[model samples]
Target: MEITPIPAPQIDLLLYHIQHHPAVLDDKTKHLITTMFQKMQDITNHGDDERRELWIPADRGTIEDFGDFEEYLTEGEVSSRDEFEELWLSEYPDSIKWYKLTTTIYENTCYVFLDNKLIFEVRPVLQNNDTKDHSELAEWLLSAVDNCLTALEKGEYNAFVADNLPYSKRIGKILREDFWRIFPEEKAAYLKDITPDEMNRFFNLIQTQPPDSPAKRLPEMTHRLFLDSCRLGYAANHYAGTNTLSSMELYRSHADGRDDGLLDINEDSPEDFAAWYHDERMRSGHPWEVCRGGNSTHISLYARCDNRGWWFTLAGSSYSRSVETVKFYLALNDHGIPAFLCDGQELAAMLAGKDYIGIVPGEVIPSYCGHLFPDENIIDFMHLPYDHTGAIIEAVTWHPLDRVTFS
Candidate 1:
């Protein structure tokens, strides 16, 4: 992936504006993000993969907005971009918003990954006027850049450009027509006509999904650790736009970049756990097809007879109705995937009375767990949706094991 051609003039214009009238800035430090950002681009390739990845870095603390010196510098500076991102986030942790744009090349396709942090920060400052409206120049600057990038995603690359190019040219037009008339000379002078250009550069691609990564090749311990995590079960994906907890949120409290992701699963593969956390079912099983073309994968339990079992239904409490929880159920139901959903009632019972045994992510030895059902009653997973996403399913169903022996 190639990316470049940032009009140097726009940089110069923003620098001049922030420097001339620094008083317009406020404690909403996130608001005055325009002039105080760093833009680092790279081109990278995945080994043996056909696709090359382009990386755009946002939240650079030391920005070269001024020709004389860099601004937005932070104390206790970190060495690498990854470290810097981590350090900046250490103080104010928030999930970064990432956007993906798909571009087709006749028979093939390419994707443009844009994280909002990498694009531009939010500008919430208002201008001094009767209406005290937002600065159109600022708004147009970011939006026009976005429009141009998105336009580049649609059709014939060149034809698309012919019609959609000059993204900044349009921004310049907007600035001249809208912003220049409102602000005083100090501020208005900085809102110059945007310059448009085309350039190219490469960046290292991010490991977007871990399951497909080479790191997925695991040894006994890593594999066991993965199973342990799965057995612990998740509390649904905390998909509040920025949450990454679906990768075994049950074990890790919150996934911060500081600690090694692999450690969360107690794996020592030197590969990040996030990579192997495919969120796919982890089990040896037989798929049982049911009505409506739906099916359920049953767990392999030695000495356990294969019997057509009743469906053990699970209704997500009002709390579990989140998009992530529903997604989890649908994903498990997909193509009859295998997964063990423990309500922890059994674990809690065993912990209280030593009645059952199971593998937990944190345990060194097989331990007893609470019994979710008594009186020889067992719940079996009968059938689930094959392709459920956003489907309003009433409950998540499960299948019970004939008997469990822990190792």
Candidate 2:
């Protein structure tokens, strides 16, 4: 399949934002992306099947026809492999937030070939380099690569390679052999190396500290460890406005203690998890003042963890909800609990024994939460309607009394 490469400015922007920010891509988008890469690997290994064997049909069909699944795949559109690739290349940045980065590598350098035919070559690049980094800018460029590689290594690409394509093995092997061919080891220290102070600075940022002096260092250590966990989960998406997780609060009110509740759900909603998460089920935009949703919905609290976490779910309605939307709040709350009400009992079962997971991004230091800050954006991403900067402040404002910790 013929593929149209990503634009130069777009590649640079993504690379820039990730090095400096954290948690930019939401879970759904991440899932979609990993699936897309998986499809890419499958095609690279087995070649186009003509039998419609691709996995991530959403992205491919979305691009070719710009509609839902039935419309795109049912017709003759799938017959044109080139059209499919072009569609994938075009829609990729939008789904995966590609406009945020501007750097590009030509396809030939990344893929491995056999039998003189194209096996895989790291999807062709339509645009090469729009922004150039000299000796002075070298350090920042290396840092950006480091962050990008980390994100990709732990993310969808890792799983896709393991499960599907043998040609697409470790990204490190590709990098050491081909990606860094332009620079020798000494000259590429900026790419291959990092400093001690940089290491300590990174550790200091993600740690959280205790309110009391004795427990302070412990918090910091935990925060650092949580960040490590995120990296391991391949959830380490860095970009502007990611560290805002410290300020999320339940939509509670004082005085009358009201919060415009609006939702209701019993055991008999649709099997899909939507009834519980969306605003439409309540038939109102505002949530009730007392409960999470309308009084109609009453989810039984299943389990409370020693890790300052809880799980409860109601099934009724779902509208205007994206994984990013829920993540938007989670990233804002410092000690926020990761909630997956839509998954129903299965998610609850997973949570049954997994209580020790700590709050992420910030490490618990002696008396303070140690958070690592990203470098300034080498590129920019689109901002949402709400004041994201304001959201950061709102997320971090926690009271000492409200502070809950788990050992």
Candidate 3:
């Protein structure tokens, strides 16, 4: 492998790289590397009242031993910086830390953590060293921005924003202009070390794949996928909504068969009535009317939901607690989603009367759908309890219309 020279802003890069890949640094090197990084990134107080607690661990290896590298380690936290360093040097006092930092002014590019400790600053060979134009730094940053946008167009969404863009747009301006009020001399060297191209490339790979993108081979896989994505239990009840938003179709059940009246619930009354029926059957404190007098009803209310894109299903002994199943129909319209809910008992009855109630009539249902498992970040925002860790396919997307057609 080819090794590159270090760029300017030396100590900062050394720490960043080491912290990310700690396995490469031995016990002693880890301490020095972490400390150096922390120092450069540390925030200070007025007139030298610089007291702050660093989150450095006392030892290495095991998960418990992993040191605190968070920027905001409190003064009361265990294993202060000095104490950690003592443990580090005790293990490898002879190990000398080394690294260098420099930039290629001609290429308008820079590198850091070079030839092991001497922090050398580099800048474009100036036409007149006597006069300085900070505008060059802004131009370099713009180049990084353009490169990042281009990478995304080329299907590289995980691009990075180095000092060039991370602090580019407005933030860069504030730092270069106002920040210098406190430390005026900081710019010349710091501005020269931004690795525009590398940073852009690194950022492009961080793209997240949406949850429902994967191929699901099972019949009602979409529901399972939603629950898993949200990490919540699939409330075993059929929830209903329209098909307006983008959503994914799991299994489409329709009221297309003969009504033997063996298992049929009221459909003409108000939504609240259906919700109440379901709540009563499930014996839940939260009364609802959807999945009332359960079994497998073709036109019954399986769930209750308000206008705010939330669905509720029955969870009780009527369906057997041991088996996780729900009777549900999804509200469609927000996304191209299909309604597929599974209540242990309801699903059993539905399957039994498959010929009567429209069950996967060997055709794809005419429903608009998108993935229920939203992009990773959106899922992260979902409250806990809803963010459980099971197969997540029960979550549903909302839509504007309330009807589904089966093949």
Candidate 4:
């Protein structure tokens, strides 16, 4: 008797049930189930015929069409097509039954059946969800940072290397190769207890100064300062930090000798020169234009407030939602602060609270009118949009609790 093919939707539902069933499967069985489930999901979501064909078995009219079919048989034990079918059915009754029932409708559906029962039903186990809570996530963040701090203090380069956190690799190598040369005990002390005001002051100081500008009697400490800034930002607290490129470096490198219509450092004031250069680079639509070069950490600080922040660091020129960013947001969420990965419009709306209603670029403008808007586009300003800038822009925001809201 001919068998009707199982519907694709029914097959998908079966796979989903097996995948999520509470069962203690051996590694091989578990991997097979997971992989097949993922492939099914991918095919369904993307509608890729090529990918579906790769996993789905094709019809074989004759035994010769099944390549290497003889390998599954004992030596000198050749059989006819009918004999082979009988042998396969006898040997793997459950699998063959499933395959015949489905008739090549789904990928790897037979593997999920063994001994006349579904694998999940045959070897069921208790399900234990291992999701971490907010306090636990917060502890993880603190532990990771504290371990790095302890490593720095103890001059243990291996500790940094062994750490799986995002900042550990570069920080480890630096400490390993040039511990005494660059990061002395005094310099290492800068990474602790960094506040938002201190970070702002550091940025203001570095804006016009050369790359070698001294802060707190240290020469060429820009990189160290940036590291210190990140140490606090990574904690996901009230503190804010940025990895801004030096305006002085831009002036010295790009503006000094170029005959191109770029802003001239000589003719314009430092403020105008910086503003014009930033705007020109931003308009060029290349993030690397502003992201790269001397003393620039290439870490984009997207947004920050009293309880939350959004930032990401690039791996070379390519943007990545790094492991550190994930950990940061996770920690923030666990601590009851709403952390999100969103575009500028969503970010603006979130900041504006539940009642915010205005056109993004034209209707809403930044409350603070500053010349150098670091990550600002026409749609949304990266900084806080306060009420004094304009009425449309003004709304209840996520600043400090004591700060008055403009009605």
Candidate 5:
């Protein structure tokens, strides 16, 4: 059905009264009212035949109850009799006796009343079949704001995080620090003012890049590198006082074992046992176990390059205990191995125009090469976790003999 338009002067007076009312209406509600007013004006300029009859209260010797009519209405449903009386008095203070004021809009039709007397009737034109159900749209728009506010108040950080919403970290900090009151109201106003078109754009951005997309995957890949770096640092510190062998010395020790009949091996064997020992130690157990005074599953292989001189290979673990552990290692940088956690932008800045090697995840092999190249002078030994793992990974990049940070 088409809309039944109301006059512009009437709409102006209604808006003035509502805006000046004692009870402050939120920005979302105000915008909704303004939009309805604009739509009504649009319909009046382009007339239609849809005429809606005014609401007539039933006469039963008692006052008509607006609460009973809520099912038939949509927006602006009268909440309580006291609230109605208060609003009515604010708009018509000169009246001797208080009159019940009820207002609501359903589809294109708006109903306004003074007690049992119908005062105004308005209907705004609906654009198309998509907006035929304006009640649902209006309700959704209001509830979206309400839900976000509630989540912020209740310290439900994951609610915002899971949706991948913008400014989630700031929202969490606001909740944790109880500093919501310090923030400007415009932040909330912006969320309330978000249009359907804008929301659709956000969803489109998310849809175009699937969960496994590189843009989404890079942060996680970097995060694993970060945790591994931390664990590597911890292991290096734990073994500081113990006697450790250089990569060549470790290999010679194993070769001597074979020569002295300590180990069964063919004399013609040409195996780098040191590298094998390092890999075996790295894969033995969870990395965080080192923090608990448990045996570390990490090994350091010292090697000397012609240009870079002497450096050690610190293998990171694929597991960690908590962020607290990371913080502990970060604060205690005396372990000789430095690891830092950086965001995407910082990592990009560090690697810009620099030669670096990327280690691709085993699964993506030839197809998905996420932010890494196989052949580069600066080796990025950081491991990339599988995309489907659902682990929260941060970004990390490493350069030999230079400070490396990961999150």
Candidate 6:
């Protein structure tokens, strides 16, 4: 529980993304967002404009009395700052409202009300004393960079990003860096808080998953893991590139088993027909040959992309709708990730309330391999969806890849 003290500029960017980004937000969150901006305006303008209509939400929690009874008590009178203090303070001295305007010049802190219910309060700290001014603060709150999201791009966002980050500049940084690209090195830790639930989810994935380090980890990274028909699925849909690139290499390894062990008896025309058939498969998005060995199966569940590292996690389903949890994990297995940390569907199964989190998996990982990741790992995450929710890492000590296999 340490305070990182994000800069005012950074904090403002975080706020703006959450408020304006078109990501799928929960009903309560969506309601809070609308009222947040409206509250900001009201606070800055001294609450002069009596709201003609209360923003009665259609979906979120309802308010039985949105000050309907209080309006008559005040005779529909607009309260000035002096009156707000005189009347409200006399009635509710212990209320946080008493300190709203007095705490900061422009009321840096204030309660955000929705349907007359206090949703949350904005009590942000200004990093620089110079940022205490109204105009600068307003600019910070309102700044919107064009095509910045495009500029922020590096790799596409996945289910983890979407579910974890709603509107986050930090996610942009993590995506750009591809920090988790390095094998078992750094994680996108700074982006979000690590919850106990997430830690359990990580362990669940790891405890059942197989290990990779070919020479170091036991049972050794085997060729048979891929030599079996799965290499077909692996090569057919694999990540040809590392975590840092936009366009991934689509490749069927030279040793891919696509053309391997062709039956001489099955082909009437023999040699020429076999060559033509293999070529056609390659051209038609199918593997041209069967692969036996030497292809890399290091499927990346996540990675630490760059040196700058992640400070905050970005949110929003918009971030990685295309790549659901299961799909990403399966893609790794398809591409030859022999031992993986976890897959989306299994990860989704651990989600608290929902059977799956983020985007649901469309196609199940084929049965040549079990859908559940069978590889063991040094560590993994357990994600919690309900009751003090979020993802946390569960670390089980296993030797590094440099260690030789004994068993």
Give stretches of model 2 more than 4 Å off.
1-7, 10-344, 353-407
lDDT of 2: 0.26
Question: Candidate 4: which pairs clash?
Answer: none
Alpha carbon lDDT of each predicted model: 0.26, 0.26, 0.26, 0.29, 0.30, 0.27
Provide the global lDDT of candidate 1 against the true structure: 0.26
Tell me model 4's lDDT, rounded to 2 decimals: 0.29
lDDT of 2 by residue, 1-407 (tens): 11123333343343444443222133333333333333333222322222111111011224423433445557866546566556556545333221111221233333221111222223333233324222222233233333334434455433432343211111111111221233245224422232344334323322332221211112111222322222221122232333443211221210013222311232233322232334354434332121233332322111112233322221221111212222222332223333223322222211121111111211112111112112211111111112333333232321121111111
1 or 5, which is superior by TM-score?
1
- TM of each candidate vs. truth: 0.17, 0.15, 0.16, 0.17, 0.17, 0.19
Per-residue alpha-carbon lDDT of candidate 5 for residues 179-218, written as tens digits (9 for 90 to 100): 1123335235423433455344433332343232122111
Q: Which ten residues in a row have the lowest lDDT in candidate 5?
A: 168-177
In candidate 1, residue 376 scores what lDDT? Answer: 26
lDDT, candidate 3, equals 0.26
By lDDT, the better pick of 3 and 6 is 6
TM-score of 1: 0.17
lDDT of 6: 0.27
Local accuracy of candidate 3 as per-residue lDDT tens digits, 1-407? 11112222232333444342212113333233333333322222112222221111111232213344242145444356666556444532322221211212124412222322222222223223233222222232223333333443453423221111110011000111322233435434432332444223322311221222211122222223332221122222222322331211112222222222212333233343335343435353312222233333222322333333333333222312212222122122112233323233333332222111111111122111112222311100111112221211112221111111111
Which residues of candidate 6, in runs, are more than 4 Å off? Answer: 1-108, 115-207, 210-327, 334-407
Rank the models by TM-score, top first: 6, 1, 4, 5, 3, 2
TM-score for candidate 3, residues paired by index: 0.16
